[model samples]
Target: MQENEVITDRDNVLFEAGIKLGALYHQFTGSPVNLDTVDSLEKGIQESISVQPCVEKISVSINRDMISSKLNGKYGYCELEGRMLDVHITAIFKTAKVDVSLAFDTELDYPLMKIEKIY
Candidate 1:
């Protein structure tokens, strides 16, 4: 996908799922949280989900709102989900950044799979 391309319904659902899952996996696994892992994370996610024919393309976005909160030990996360594309973000005061993970299946409304957190 292009760097600035806007997400659309025509995009592959599995790819979308992989992007979201990859973001969550890296978010929870990183120390000091290197946002660069997003690329590697995306690659890993794509490889795992490539078996699914439904997936076509994938994209991801990260909110750097926490840039100033580093000194304060404050961490934040952003995630989008569902047809309405609800957004949720939370800030926490801790050594590690928070993570946001979500899982879905053929049906959009119900979460068939999920990661522990969404950061």
Candidate 2:
């Protein structure tokens, strides 16, 4: 593939991955962050990639990554805490330039309220 083509493909992958991660963040957080929010955030990120002047603007490659996630928060009625998930992602791309590595983290917890007085 031509260098430009490769760059395009890699950028697409990165953008998609960012969106996926944003969705996962909402899921893990038990929140309502949707496609609109993801799209908005991603646009800013992409723009930054293009506008920011930098040297050796090539690509990047990642591999053998291990992710360990832990969650701890108050659930109102009771404190809820535990390991939410763990993942290992292997990403590969061109190097020598500004390669944006997007990392996201989220904490999720559900709370139950107790009645103080009977009505």
- Per-model TM values vs. the true structure: 0.26, 0.27
Going through the candidates in the order shown, the clash numbers are 8, 4
> Distance from true position, residue 45, model 2, in Å?
25
Candidate 2 C-alpha lDDT tens digits along 45-95: 333333332311222111111111111133212111112222222222343
What TM-score would candidate 1 get against the native? 0.26
Error of 1 at 82 (Å): 12
Candidate 1 lDDT by residue in tens digits, 3-28: 99885442333344445554444443
- Candidate closest to the true structure, highest lDDT: 1
Model 1 scores worst on lDDT over the 10 consecutive residues at 82-91
Candidate-wise lDDT, in order: 0.36, 0.29
